[model samples]
Target: MSDLSPTEVVEIEICRRPIFVVGSQRSGTTILASSLRHHGALWYSTEGYILNEIFGPERLDETYAVARLNLNRWLAREGVTREEFLERMGLGFNVLLSSRSGGKRWIEKTPENSLMIEVLGTMFPGACFIHILRDGRGAVNSMVNKRTAPGWVTDITWACRAWRRYVDAALEYAASHPDRCLTVRYEELVADPEEGFEAIYQFIGVPYDRAPMDFFRTHRTSSSFRRRIRSRSSHEALADLWDVWPLQFKRIFLEDAGVAMLRYGMVSEEEMQQMVEDARDPSDESPSWTEELEGYRSRRDLAAVVERGVPRDAVMLVVSKGDERLLELGDREAWHFPRDEDGGHPGYHPADSEEAIARLEWLRARGAEYLVFPEGSLWWLEHYTGFRDHLAARYPRVVDELDKCMIYGLQSVRQVPTA
Candidate 1:
């Protein structure tokens, strides 16, 4: 991509003053974005294809790194520079929505945006961010029930982990950019739409009005979509986690979810303590052992928590050692690097040179188009650092890295000279 004149870039930037709405999947981001889109002063997109051009399929796992790669490609493809690309991508909705928004500020929301705050920040220096957070357990149940949870999302354990990631990112950015950011909780947002949206409006420096909230309530032409998203009493949702999620993930809910829960005030200390006590492994006599999982925790470690069957076991690939024990698969082949009896995991990643070659070979042989690496395996991606570079190098071939997982397209990747 060639650099553009500074004046041209600045002109494009001037045309773009956008707001981004982001949060975990099933966290009410869609409804909030939908409501905001109706504003006469704004236009928003539910699933803008331009984002796919910007960052493959919204690889939230390593958003910034991968987006940087795609941003350059997007710039070249659009015949724009970094600044021009930012302006074009950030405000492209104006053109998509055409005259509907009357050239007002555009809004875009994708669950992966939560993890891409820094990347978006770089794109639109002065843009506002509205982050919606849902209770970890509530989000887990809603996400799992969907079954079509994004590729970046794996299961209950990773669901909670992914939520914590987004909330933590929102909170961190809010701290640094207090004037530019707002955090809204899904439960509270639905409980009081007027109040929730008012806070959002004020945070965006727009006049507070109840009309947008009313529009959201009245614009439900599809009862099913509305019902799927409408706020409901979810106090019983916590109990559903126990029956739905595996044991290891329950421990993650007890151990790893605390920092964000406490920081965001999602759960009280007393309630969290009770949850921890209830989720304690019976074999471990030490009650406080969960804290030991703090620093060195890995996706593989959390995955090792399942000792019994979990619902929705017929997945593409089970990430843990207890697949045979916890998964009720009949004839489906589970992909892993062939484990040994001692319970050690396979030390293979598609990133490894030789491994990438062999992995692509095996996948092609099976006529597979896509391969899923559960979010659990890549939760703390830096723990396995070069992972993003590996996928980013594969570009459009890698496809998606959102919904808590990495999906590789075998045909596209196979064409990449075995990266």
Candidate 2:
């Protein structure tokens, strides 16, 4: 001890307060957490279910009397007072999270955490929460389509009720703890991601960084449902799903979720009543919604080919037809076909096969190592025979799944002289 210097002494500071992201399932929580993970000052771990098991009570009341009663019995057995038990538990939790935080603020995201905000607040007094609120129609639609396993709500009526319950509880907490909680709307976040994320950064006391705005390019979300819904625009997809609902299901949704929907500005009272009227005159003709959805799902199957065939860090030019979702599939660098001079979407296709071939060569010269054609863009091969032939003659085909996609390796191809 006499020989020890100040530099030799080790001091460990526990992180008692961490950021939490909470929401109803399929309400943009995953994407929000994924984006926040990119922040240099933050570390986001997978959902922490352990917190709920340990701290969350069966019934959450304003007084928390039931939780206190249960904890007090356990505290007595440990020979500690309530204050001492909480101090130790808080320290242990901080130690566990800090061990993996990489010396940055930690974030925990679990949809179920939306119900445990009050409990978590008591456990970590300084903890901040972000609640992502989605339109109940969109959230319930996704929930019904995905059909998550093991006790997840699958019925449309139950799904609507679940969404309303989560939203109502979170909003109630936010009303009392305005400084500690922030509520973000999913539609607004996607409409202007940069502005939305900037506000989030400010609220979390972190420096704003633009990297999070490009999360779609960097983070890969499990999006099979998203792929199926790609047959139409998001608005069209939601409208189609709503129109197909039976009269009873429509009434159930309106009864269970209509008020929360209005509170969140998702729909006006007039629109809600209009839905009720629309449900009465059910059309006899069925829409081809299922077939259209499956068609797009099959078209996106090419994403698997890209993930397996393309090398990591290689540059790929995908015939996406302006769909950025394809670019998020693999670990490779991808750009849209027919990109402009600045490497952005050109907003139009090539004028002819000659223009297409010219653009192909230009992109290749700029380090594009592969060209991929998913089924959705296979028409390009039929429409631009010259460009197709150019690729076939010069580049070796790496993947040739007939109904999925075709991949052409461009890195080592010898350019054939123009005829």
Candidate 3:
């Protein structure tokens, strides 16, 4: 418990000049945050989760709700001023970040923050926001490559459409409160980070410096994590980033990220037609539905934890011996534990008791950030006397989900204060 009383805690301001980076998912928010973290005046989050950590993701729902009754109960228990409760509940995290800040303000990035203008604005009055805009094609392609797109988002057309909707809502919110928001295009940022970052610093009311542009060389990060966040090669900036989406979306490359994407809020008819033409008209042999579904599920498991933002050195414990094979394609695998010739399957469930709590702690002791039960392969262990649920009941969290195949993080359960 805080030594400070509840009233005093409510009065205390935790973060001054909070900065949030928001935009469509996969729109370079992470890269932007990683680079900005190099600045002397900013402490970017390693836990890449946004304000929701303080608000909620405490349950699994696409719409992000636990229950109306639960919300009311929390409101009653914590007191009516949600902001005060939020600040107090979040005090530990704030203290931790402040220690990490080097006297700088905190800069938080979570693509989902794009939908959270009003809540964020309320939480941190006059806080600055940087919204990074990527061309829809590039964003879609990247989502497919990273497999972070939500389950319903199937192909390039749907992906682009989803981008259009999200970008519209986020930018509209930003426009409503112009002084606090700055929208930067991804192409421009990667093309000339020094100038781009200068504009960013100016918008966020910080001194422009050369540190961020040289982040890769100067900043401290693991070799693998360093390798992952490295800025894109200018050479790869071909017209627009293009890779052929197999089957449905075909070879849709937006060398310029397409002019149409820029007009998401006020798209002209001609631009819409051009975008449709770009995504379709030609097709390759589509992968079977089973193949696509499996791939989606595989990536879904990965994204559940990775999207939460993790320390560069976080280590994932893959439950299956050969499950690591699926990691070949994407750069997010930087979070994977070092290939332990010693670490593979756990061999077998405990003979003493089927309960997995002891096993979980054992894995945590061995430096596991998350435990992946790929494709429900660990059903025997998880289903043992509702072991997953038993642990979840004791340690409720945003990541406290009971899925047959999911990435259950050891760090996740610890987010809640024991008291």
Candidate 4:
């Protein structure tokens, strides 16, 4: 700090390729960036705006002229050409990042970075960009629901256009620099994270490690926001919302995002036409079902049920459907039902009641003291009748409320005949 000028400090050669994770807001960019932050070789920051601030298109011609004149004067006084100034700025960014990166490569994430891909590519020629794309409907729905900031887009048309704009910008950049950029779909990544993250690591020229995949287990994003709007399964929730949106909203979304959706294979022409027709004559316009869906999504009462009913220090197996919210509700230890060998969520329900019973016995044998079925997963009781009967005939019900959850005390196993 005492020995060198800012210019002198920024002269260090940049040796590593920085990773830029760019995507539309609410397109899983935060989750992706948070996961990558767990990688030992990468240092991730919330958002980097310097590049965009310096290179973004000016909104007003007068402001642009004044800014350019002042910038040129400063550059002339500093005795550096514009290109040299840019090079040093890039190096300076790297130096600052490297300081906190602990000698590892650095990663930056910002939804707005989707629009600054060309500038980023020019500044860091060796940079790797991961463009995460989500289904436009889901992205727009989330954007409209979670209008967290004052200037955030809330209208259907504006949200749809914004999502398409970011997606098109990133995809356009990826098309030209295929070697340096990779586009990852949010749905595919959620479905099979191992394959997705493996490809990501390979593209970024880093050794693949399984630790980063555990980020979902360790990280919780906006629990309050999630409790308000998110469902146990985002894919299913989005599908339900799409089915219920009015005809006008659907047309607006399609007009702004239809082509991009087709490009991603999210919807075909036949399906798009079918969706439009279906929206025109929705079978159920009653608000009751929508309210029920929202109630199911919220899980507000379920949290209270878990916190109040589940005993402290009990090892519980929860039929969570990959939602991690319940995992944080109590002091007890919780594991997803039908969990993998590593205790991670299996991401799907058992194929049959027999399999469900087998998984239950497996977890019980491994010291699972209680079994929980949250409100969202109560369908398992009806769907897996044999498993439900076995539990009812054997383990005593510790907590059962129609609107909340069902908990079975698994202190002792009894040989009960299945129906």
Candidate 5:
């Protein structure tokens, strides 16, 4: 038995209104939401993927069904009845206050949640929405400047289209439900955090504390891509990373020229024409994980393991006791040494002068690509070369013959224990 202490786990919740934070990508959403996590009574995750699993890509027609499913799933997982789930969601205040400890609020933030605000409102009538908006020009500029998909790199035109679409959806949702929505522009947050947080504080009905705002300065990394990125200051700084033409185009066609911008009264008229021109030429490429290893083969192997009883792929070869447990776990074969009755070659002894050479030859003959002779075993085998160098010499042969095999290396600690 392990020596470490074991304790029972207790799950508790104290908040009722599930706070939903939504915003555009690279729009300071993570920093803002993660900062709010330090708030007492708040339990949240940055961009929970559960919504995508439940909702299936944010289409409007199926939104109601998806919301119901999400609610039901949450209820079942939390071991709460439907009535309790409904009450908790409606109160929006109970979950935070019900905790045994000081913590109280429960919230989740995801950029895609921006598209599902209406569905969310229907699901949790007591819910509050924090919509984080970045400057459209800066948003476009930021997308182009940072490590982005090939589509973003292909041209400023495509980037601008995406920006407008995201911002338009966000604004439309905000306008539709002004009472429930709280808009925090990224630029405002950076320039005057007190003002921005005051707006957030007022919307959520929580007293604003300046201390949590500093949490934004804490390092932020994109959970989706798993990359570290520097936080931007003002929206204008985002354009610093892009070329002049892209910045101009974002300012004109996408941010300044469009009716959406005019409605928001955000961008200037002078910027619109260049944005239109940029939109005329589109970049066709899109981002994908090209460097990731081909996963289909691994997936197929996993499926085989689950469905079939056969022992296949990366079996652990263990030295067995008389009980034969290892054989039960993995396919077994006799390992004869020194030319046994089966006419197999002799196993090399640790004491032999040419033991290392013999062991290598033995492995080659037995069709064993990798002979994992642990550290001390080599000294007995009369081997002098370092383990790494010895492996390097035979690596090519191993690849040619047994690349599919994985050999487990171990030190011979003790004789196999018999039960």
Candidate 6:
């Protein structure tokens, strides 16, 4: 302010800045990153995992540099050169930002970015951070409910330890980089996103426009950007809707992550463990009563999704009868098809043929040893009538390329079925 030049001011106005969002898995980092990405020039990904995969699982002095180098090479492979790459890298990031049209800033996001904030700071001194905080109890509950990595919720104690490690590591980095960090609570963001986004937009020097809200009105496809927006809004709303979760949900959540909950101001520890103990062993005469009830319900109500009929030693295809492989290997000894109606032929529709070819292509891509083809009357009639000729032409060489295996069916067939 004392003697700032006009040129410097102008440069600052147009310059791009790096933004990093950090948090444990399932802690609303994606929503924050995406919300910002919706209207900003930044880019980010869910969790790049590149740093962990390439430079080694633990952080090291050379890890950050190696990550940056790999990213640059990846970009170059995608047709960006050194100078252009640097400019774009500074401008924006996303899980994959190559498709972002008309954005000036580079943005990329990975939760592990927090672990390397110091290294990132050294490389790009202007990097700013958005650290998301979810209530530890809620976070733990969410993690437990999720299909997680093995042993994630075997006990509350281990969950607490894992949750604390990530949160504490993030906090330590943010503490050192006060000027470059913004701590955003998930509850606050969901409750008043405009208020939250305002803070974020100001921090990142982006123009805040509600125009992107209209983007939400369009029907979102399964994997499109709009899908990401809709999913976030739905998740946030559900979090608010679960205000009346059972006492068990709360106790399990708290017991699992109560320490981190206290550190983040979500709870106070003086809250006795007696409450949890009482819940777990509700003095209901028999200790195994609850287990018995669960077992009974599972046996009586739940569909037998896990088919026990398939012998442990026999190879189970669990396929549809109309599946070409089903007919082709009608009498094959090695293959076993599902007995259920739905698991059999889904019919000879155009989509079915296309789906079959796609499945074959996928199998080929994954290095399949055998190709299965059904030989039902419907399949033969369709094949003879060129029902799937277009697909055959498209993937002409797929069937011929199996050097190691043969086209076989679940059961051996005497002859191709004719309509």
Q: What is the alpha-carbon RMSD of candidate 3 to the true structure?
A: 20.8
Q: Scored by CA lDDT, what does every candidate get?
A: 0.58, 0.76, 0.57, 0.76, 0.51, 0.48
Query: Which stretches in model 1 have alpha-carbon errors above 4 Å?
Result: 1-15, 52-100, 150-154, 218-249, 287-289, 292-419
Residue 156 lDDT (model 3): 58
> Tens-digit lDDT track for model 1 on 1-419?
76766565333223255788877777777777788876667777565545535554344335434555674655345555555555445454444544445567777787777766765775677689998877877776566566554765655667777777877777778777888888887767766788888888878877766667987667632211224233435444444444446667667666656556655776666776666667778797664435443322333222332212222232233433333422222333445422323433455444444555454445446544334455454442454345445555653433334444454544454235644
Task: Give stretches of model 3 more than 4 Å off.
Answer: 1-13, 53-93, 147-158, 216-247, 250-262, 265-273, 276-419
- Which candidate, 3 or 6, has the higher lDDT? 3
Query: Tens digit of lDDT per residue, candidate 6, span 166-195?
Result: 677777777777788778877677666667
Which of 4 and 6 is ahead in lDDT?
Answer: 4
Estimate the lDDT of model 4: 0.76
* Cα TM-score per model: 0.53, 0.57, 0.48, 0.57, 0.47, 0.44
Tell me the deviation in Å of residue 133 in model 2. 0.5
Off by over 4 Å in 4: 1-15, 57-85, 217-237, 279-419
All-Cα superposition RMSD per candidate: 18.0, 20.7, 20.8, 20.6, 22.7, 21.6
249-320: candidate 3 lDDT, tens digit per residue: 533322222333433432344654444455553343342332433454465554555456434455665555
Q: How close is candidate 2 to the true structure, as a TM-score?
A: 0.57
Report the Cα lDDT for candidate 2. Answer: 0.76
Clashing pairs in 1: 150-403, 151-405, 152-402, 152-403, 152-404, 152-405, 153-403, 153-404, 248-305
- lDDT tens per residue, model 4, 1-419: 48756674334545469899999988888888888988888888677776666656332233334545774666445665544545555676777787777778888888887886776675676788999998888788778777474455778888898898899899988988899899998878876788999999999998987878788445635422244235546566565677767777776775677656755678765766566556443654542323432443346567678778877878988888877766655467888887888889888889999999999988888999988888778899999999989898889998989777899999986777668
Tell me the lDDT of candidate 6: 0.48
Error of 1 at 10 (Å): 13
Deviation in angstroms for 315 in model 2? 69
Candidate 5 achieves a global lDDT of 0.51
The list of candidate 6 runs beyond 4 A from truth reads: 1-16, 44-46, 56-58, 62-103, 147-158, 211-256, 268-419
Query: Distance from true position, residue 87, model 4, in Å?
Result: 3.3
Question: Can you give the lDDT of residue 274 in candidate 3?
Answer: 48
